[model samples]
Target: MTVTRDSITDFVRTLEDDISRVAICGTSYSDIGGVARVIEQQAIELRNGGYDIDIFTLEGTRKPPEDVSLHALGHFETSPYKEVDKLLTLASPSALNFVRSANRFDLIITHRFPFSTLGHMAKVIHNVPYVYWSHPSGSSDELFEGLAHAWARVQHHLETQNYAVRKADYLCAVSEESGEYIEAKTGREAVVVPNTITESRFGDVADEKKINEQFGLTPHDTIVLHVGRISPRKNIHRLIEAFQAATEGEAECKLLLVGEESMPEYSDRVRELADDDVVLTGFVDDKTLAGIYNRSNVYATCSLSEGWGLPLSEASYFDLEIVAFESIPAVNSLDGAYPVVNEDYDEFREKLCEKVNRD
Candidate 1:
C-alpha cells in the first residue's frame, strides 16, 4: 500500500479501530538521539488519539508522558563492551519470555534492531502484527574503520537488521533514501514518513540572554551550531577543523556542539580538536535546545550520512542558515541549504565562512 505524507495520519487512524492497544519497542527511552525522539513523538501522538500506547524497552531511564505506560524488560547490561551488550540483548531469553507472558498487544511498532527482534517474536508467538520503522543503515564503511572486531559487528548488523526487515508485517522509513535502502537490501517496500518538526514547540522569540548566560556567550558571538550525537559517523572532527578554518581570526565567533556523546573515544578525539572557542553542550532539555537553535547564527553539519537529519529540519524551522555536505542524503533532500563537496574540507570551510560572515 502506498502511504503518502497526506495519507500517513489517515492510515494510522484506520489502524485505531482494529488495533486499540499498541506497543512501541526500542532499546531505550532516553533522549540520546533521534530514534528516541521519534519513539517519544509516536507514543505521544498515539496516546493523544485515544490509543492505548505501551512502550517496551531494554532499559528505561526517561519517564514516558502522562497516560503512556513504560515497561523495562531489564535485559541490558552496563558493560564496557558495547557490542557484547548488544549481542546479549538480541539473544536475551528473558526478553523473549517477557513477550510470551505479557499481555497480548494489538500491534507492535519497532524502532531498531534487538528490540525489533522482540516484535518478530511477538508476531511468531502471539500472532501479533508488527511494523518496523527503518532508520539509516549504520553499516557505513567509514563507521567500521579502525574499530576492533569490525567485521563481526558488520556481519551481525547485516544479519539481524535484514532479518527484521524481511520478517516485518509492514515497513516504514524515516526518509525516501531510507525506504530505497530497505528495498535494495531486503526487497521490501517501505512507506516514507519523514521526520517532522513542530514549530509551536519553539518560542516566537529566542531567549538569547538565557543561551548567552548558559554558554558564556556575548551578543557579538556568531554561533555555528551542530546538534546530534557525537559519534564517528557524524564526522565531528572534520566539522571542528572546518569551523576553525572558517572562523579564523574572528574572535567573537564560536562553534557550539550539542547532544550526548555516543562514542566516547571518538568524542574525546573531537574534544581534543576543539579549542576554547568551541563549546560542547552535551544532552540538553528541549527548552534549552530550542533556545540554542533560536540564538544560533547558522546550523552546520559534516555528517557522512543520515536517515533524515532531524536537526536540519528543526534548524530550517528556526530559519538559520544551513551548511552541510552535498553527499549527505538529508542535505540533498533539503532546499536552500548550502552543500559543499563530500570530504572537501577546503570547500566546506569556504562555504561555512561565507554563510557565517553573511550575517
Candidate 2:
C-alpha cells in the first residue's frame, strides 16, 4: 500500500483502539547482536501492553520472553551470492503459505530486508499495515568493503533497503542520525524510537564470584569491556592495539572482548592481535554479561558505526565509565560518555588509560 501523510495520521489516531495483534519479522533471534535484542524487547513490550505478539524469523536460537509466540522458519543453505539464501527462504512456498495461513496480524513490524520484503508482501496481500524498523542506513560501501561479492551485497542492500523504506506504511529509526540517513536516501521521514536499556536488569548486585570464576579475574583487576560482534566494522583490531598500548605495563588491567565472531577472517585477525591481557569471551548470556558489566571498570567501543549502540546504553545502566570516539552516533547521543576525537588513537589510548587507572 502507498502510504500518505493523511493515511499515516489517521492510522496513528486509531492505533490504540484498532491495533492489538502484532507480527515482528526479522532474520534471527540470537543471544547476541543489537537487532535481535531490539526485536525481543519490542515483543515483550507489546505483549505487556495486552497486544498479542508473534515473532517470525528464519532462526530463533534464543527463547523469547513470556507470552510472546515465536515461529522459526527452517534455515536454508548458504548461497554463494549476497543475501540469496535469505531471499530464497523468505520467498519460498512454505514461508508464503505460513504467512497466508497464519492468523491475521493487525500490524507487522519489520527489521532487515528481504525479511522486510516478506512483510511488504503481507501488506500487499492481506492489507495489514507494516512498519519498517530502520537499523543501519547510509551507504553500504563501508560495511561491505573487503568482503567477497562486495558489489553484489551493496547492490542488494540498495534495492532491498530502499524498497522497504519506500513501501512501509510507516518507518521507525533507532537513532536520529539513522533517521536523517533514511530521509536522505529515500526522502521518507522516520520517527526516532531510540533503543533503551532496562535499568532493573542492571539494578541488582553483580555476581562478582561468577565473574571471577568465569574469566579468572579477581576484584583487584581493572576490567575494560567491549560487548558487540567481533566484526571488522567493530574496529576490534584498533581497539586491541589501543588497549595494549594503554595498559602496556599495567598487568592488573584486562580487556574483555565479548560477543560471538560474526566474521571469521576478521575474528582471526583480532585473535592474532590479542595477547595474554586480552580475553575474547565469545557470546555470554545476559545474566553473565550483566555481571561482567558490573565488575568492569570501564566500557569501551571503537565501532566504526552503530544504529543506537545498545551495549553502550547497557554500560551506562551499570554506571561504568564509557570511552568511545566522538564520531560514533550512539556515543555522541550518550551522556556522561568520554568521547575522544575520531581516529585519534593516541588520544583514544590516553583517555582509555585514564579511565582504567581512575579509582
Candidate 3:
C-alpha cells in the first residue's frame, strides 16, 4: 500500500502497540548533519510521546537524556579504497549484533543509504518489518562533472541501496523530491515527514556578548551563518566566495561555519579561500547552535541539492532571512527564504548583501 503521512502515523501507532521496543539504526549520528539531527529529534519526540526508541549508530557519542538509550560501535575504515566506507558501514557487524542481542524488536527504522541495508538484513534474518528513511539518491553524482571514476562506485552503492529500498516494509522521505527519487528508483512510494523545529527549544539569544566574544565579533558585525557539513556537495566554497564579494573589505561583517568537515580535502580548499574573518567552529551543541542562529543576521547555503533544508527552516524560525539556490526544493517551502538562480554566485552575493542591508 502507498504510504501517506496519515498512514505512517497510523502505522507507527500500530507498531507502538504491537512492539515493546524499536531500534533506530544509522551509519553515523550526531547533532551535526541534517540526517543525524532529524533522527535524533525523532527519537526524542517519540520517547517524549511515550514510545520506546533506542538509537544504534555505527560511530558517535551517546549524549541523549537519561531515559533515552544510545548504542555506538566505533567507526571502521573500509579499505585502502575511498568511498567504499559507505558500503563497509552497511555491512557493520555492530548492527547485526544489536539486532541479535534483542533477539527481536517490534520494528526497525533505518536512515539514509547503506545503513538501511541493516534494516534489510534484519528482515531477512528475523522476519522483522523495517522502515527505511530515504535520503538523496546516489544518482545525485550524475549532476556533478569529473566524477566518472566515482560514478561507477556510486552506482554500485546505489544498486545496493535500491535493493534495500525494495526490501523495506515501509519507506519515508524527508522531502517530496526525495520521495519521488525513491519511487523512480525503487518503484515504491514513500511518506514525507519533513525535519522539524521545536519552538520551545529556542529562546532569546544567549548573551550576545558571550557569543560575539566566542566568535571574535563586535556589536556592529553582521553574521552570515552557514551550518552543516563542509563538503563539495554543500557548495560551501561558493558561499565563501559570495560572502567575500558581497562584503569585500568590510571589517564589520563576518561569516561563521558551524559544523564538522565531512571532506577534509574540501575543507582545506574552502579554508584556502577564506580570510581571517571566516570562523569555522567545527561543531557545536544544539544550545550553542540555537544561540548562533538567533545571533546571526541571515542564513545562507548554496548546496547543490538537499533532501530537506532543515537548517534554513531552523533559521526561518528565528526570523532570519534565507539565501539559497533556487533549485533547492526544501527551502522553497520555507517562509523568508530567498532563492537565487542555481550556481549564480553574482546573484547570490547580491542577495546576501541585500539581506544584510535590510537587516
The lDDT leader among the candidates is 1
Give per-residue CA lDDT, model 1, range 159-230, as digits (tens).
335676588898888777777777677777778887776444465554889899999999999999999888
Any runs in candidate 1 off by more than 4 Å, and if so which?
A: 1-3, 6-8, 14-17, 91-94, 101-103, 144-161, 198-206, 333-336
lDDT of 2: 0.77
lDDT of 2 by residue, 1-359 (tens): 22323222243445556887888878888777788888887777667667788888777888887888888886567755435576567667768875685448888888886667777778888888888887774443554445444754654464335675588887877777777777666777777777776554455555998787889887789999999988767889999999999999997989999999877777889989999899899988777888898898899888756777889988888788899987566687777698889788899999998988784
Which stretches of model 3 miss by more than 4 angstroms? 1-11, 14-17, 78-83, 89-93, 101-103, 137-156, 159-161, 198-205
lDDT of 3 by residue, 1-359 (tens): 44456333444775546765778877677666677767777777777666678887776664764477888865557554444566666446775576566445778888765557767777888888888887674345543445434755574456435678787998788767777777777777777777676554565447678888888888998999998888767888888988888887677888999888866667898899999889998887666888899889999998867777788888988888899987776667888898898878888999998887766
Pairwise lDDT winner, candidates 1 and 2 = 1
- Supply the global lDDT for candidate 1: 0.78
Best by TM-score: 1
lDDT of 3: 0.75
The candidate 3 region of ten consecutive residues with least summed lDDT is: 1-10
lDDT of each: 0.78, 0.77, 0.75
